[model samples]
Target: MAELFARDTLSSQRWRRRLVPNQSFTLGRSTQKYPVVWDKQISSQHAQLNWNGVQLEIRKIEEAANPIFFGSRPRISFMLDPGQHFVIGHTEFLLENSEPTMPLPHRSPRTEVTIRPEEIRRTSFRKTPGRIELLTELVSKMTASTDHDQLITIALQQLLHGIPHATDVQLLEQSLDGDTKTFSPIAWDSRDGVSTPGGSSQSLIENATTSHMCVLHVWPNEPDPATADFTQIAGHDWAMCIPLEIKLNQVAALYISGKRARLEGNLTEVEILQDDIKFAELVGSTFANLSRNMALERRQSQLNQFFTPGLLDHVSTDIESYLAPREAGLMVLFCDLRGFSAATEDNIDRLIPHLHQTSETLSIITSAILAQQGVIGDFHGDAVMGFWGWPVSASENPLGGIQAAWEIVQTLAGTEFLCSDTPAKAGIGIAAGQAVAGMIGSRDQVKVTAFGPPVNLASRIEGMTKPLGIPLLLDDHAVTQLQSHPSMPPNTFLRLGSFRLSGLRQETQIFTVNSGEIAWLPEFSQALILFEEGDWPQAISILQSLPTQFGPRNLLLQYMQGFQNQCPASWSGTIERNTK
Candidate 1:
């Protein structure tokens, strides 16, 4: 299948007829016929005509537009050059013969096309220096599109006006079993859909092994049923036949046409019609490659640097810092997988995939956190440390952390993996306080990691979750801050009284994660409550105790570290929590 098409396209009949201009093209006062007018005027400026696969240069400017059409005869008359007639096809070129020339269409090496003066009459030529310029302009505009629909829309619009005779513009997509889903490709372009001579609302595209069959017929029977690859349909005095080449059924083709009442001097002339086919093929290839790159970029943009691609792009220091030289409040989160090491003893491969899936699930949750203005700090071999209030300073880092933890628990616990039924569980810890955030790493791996005492405390609390049979625990700072908020979700938060979080002289207050639809919201609102109550010490304590796991915990850890050293030590030690 791959080696089917040869590089020799000089012998095919698909080459467009080249026009030999005798007189310069006559410009008319017709604003409707040609909407675009280039101010730069330099005739016979080494212009090229691209037909099926041939490239022919026009020595003189007998007449030409951006892409003149020969498929239709003019309602009026136009001048033509004699010695070297041009043909439009996959490429554009001049015919050496004084009379009609042989077809130069092809499968490969789609250039060096030829046409006699008698073969071509209608044609539009742009003043582009070369194909590179034409393709560059197309690439710039097509990729600028925001979405898939917008990209298609713009392409459609350009085709309507750019082509010589294209009407009732429509796009078609192929389906399985060599069938087609008609009346689609509603992508926007410069011009909307318009009716044309050969236009039809209904279309059938047969997706085949080697080639595609596009048939458009009237109320009568199908046209040329015997022809599997190439067939023509003429109804209401209009006809169009498309032959497609396919590889692995990845359906793709370009269909462009328009209506014109007056076609003469070379109307339906083999030279002119062939040119249109080649032109369509080239346009299709250029546009397709350009769009694929744009889509790839768009996908990369949506991902978080750490989880999206764990690769490098633009690493900005100022952009990375939440607290460059001052202080800011933050929320810390700690996430650790329970029984993970034991479960993976013999099932390392199984465990890895499960962990990946869990991490992906957590990544989604973290995106939601950042969407609401949050961040993740670090990932610690199955453990996570996160924070907010820097990178995107919001008063909800603590609450956001809690929300992230609860979501992970619910999303994982409910999911049953077909590959392995390892218990999906995570321990989460939340805190609030001052910390520093900015770029801090070697050239090999530069990232925005946080530092401070609050981060360490969060780590201690996370380590204690399994021992206490508690999946989530919020500190004094998070509890007081979240409770004061009226929009906090309705959940039962039990006051686990006072608890020691390793190395801390005083017993830190903690809260546990529970079930409910709105569990995530409270996690976001916790930071606001802590700051409002003016519990600076407790806030710093909770904020510093972030885990080193992969999701929100990492962000919280970063934020808390950035703030810990800068904040005031004044704190209120009341860690009260409520849930329903």
Candidate 2:
């Protein structure tokens, strides 16, 4: 014979097996499917020739371990295209060859017999490269999904369809000693080759038990599990055994006979045994590096979630390292979502996207605030509450707050909601002062919100429109801070004469924003007077009554949602302004 193919020596590890007094070989077979085998006999050194048809690779005939009646040595298997039998070599073994026995109450869900290859969808792997390697790759993708089970079932189905006489497949696994061990793992590969969903899992944790690892029989019987591995699995029939194992975080296993094989190949199976070693230890170590990098990404995301890019710029150390609670003269700005309540009914289909779009709007403002080194507080539902400076900038630029607010108002005013029938609008409120800044709110409500008079004033201005009927408002303190700022849009704001704020004894000189210093002015007082007089229907009608309007129209569109839609038909021209 040609010298056996010399192959690379695999890892040579010390492995010893304890001899048992009951040292006997079992022959197993099943009537439902093919017989699987332990292939530790696999010689990386030599390639085996395909034999027993396309179903098996032929090994040496003497090594087949054929069954004998006398019973002098270990054991042998038999071909049971009919009864897939397993013959055991033990003292006082059965004297006669018997038919494979069926399990009691055999109407079990897992016992459905699957015989045809087409019964399940399995294509013979004809691709170049390793057959086992292909099996490994496909098997690697399986999870607890039913698709995984279907894959294996399809393979068995195809095998049965081609060799209609074949039945009784067996199962095997690697033992703690890293040796092959076969057993009567349960399965039905005949009627619905898709019977027992053998291996698949959603969690890597569950993979511990369901991974396919190895098989037992090396040769095929006349298309039957019974005679397939009679020597390996005896006295059982009509079932399949699967051995599961995980290697390198990937899993693989084997399948075999079930409750049908009688004398020889009844339940004989192929096995792959690995010692009780921590496979995950090697796996975890490999994943540890990946875990660290993933951890960094998670940390980065967490930080980005809280800080605006502009705010992130000055924050030099890790996010956990510092906190600043005071600012010299930072401006405080609040951007309120106007006409927000009606969105619940008006744009029911747009709830999520609206929220997201709203967040993006707030994000744009936050981004601008961050650009100018401003800090952001928590968003209270429909309103964004935050102060500029501190934590991000130690000293506040009251002008920075005004500029940020002005830019915010301008951005939203000019920008239309892509989803809106009309452009979306918001209210901008600006206030500036020396204020405290530290974490506020009780433990239960602990939020990175701000404190101090400027914050309250900004928040109050955000809602001032309901009373003063303005899209944008600035407290006198804010105006003073921005009086010299270079970026302030040149706009002639209509001054609303001083009025005593509720808490303060003195009047706070406030102003309603009219137009950008560079743009055409609007009739701010008239609109304010109508809205304040509770003539909202006419208030919206008057604005809806404009031609090629100014930037502030966005707020009116929102405010109009709050007013009744019983206005006169003359407004339809502008209403089509949005519908168009």
Best by lDDT: 1
Against the true structure, whose TM-score is highest?
A: 2
lDDT of 2 at 259: 31
lDDT of 2 by residue, 49-137 (tens): 22132121222234344333222433323222211212222211111112222222221221222222122123232221333443343
- Which regions of candidate 1 fall more than 4 Å away from where they truly are? 1-326, 349-373, 396-398, 412-424, 488-492, 513-580
In angstroms, what RMSD does candidate 1 have relative to the true structure? 23.8
**In candidate 1, residue 146 scores what lDDT?**
49
Candidate 1 matches the true fold with a TM-score of: 0.36
lDDT of 1 by residue, 1-580 (tens): 0000001124321111222333222222122111112222322232332222222222223454433323342112222332233222222222332221111111111112232222322444322234344445556766664444434444454444444455433444444344733332322121222122233223222321123433222122233345411212322222223433222223444444333324445454333434543344445544555556555565345336432231223324333242243356777776777666775675776876877866775575566445444556777766767676665554524356656666665665442211113434776677777877555567686555567766776787766565444556778877777776677765546544355555666667766544444433343335425543655446445544433221233333343355563443543433221210
Tell me the whole-model lDDT of each prediction, alpha carbons only. Answer: 0.43, 0.42
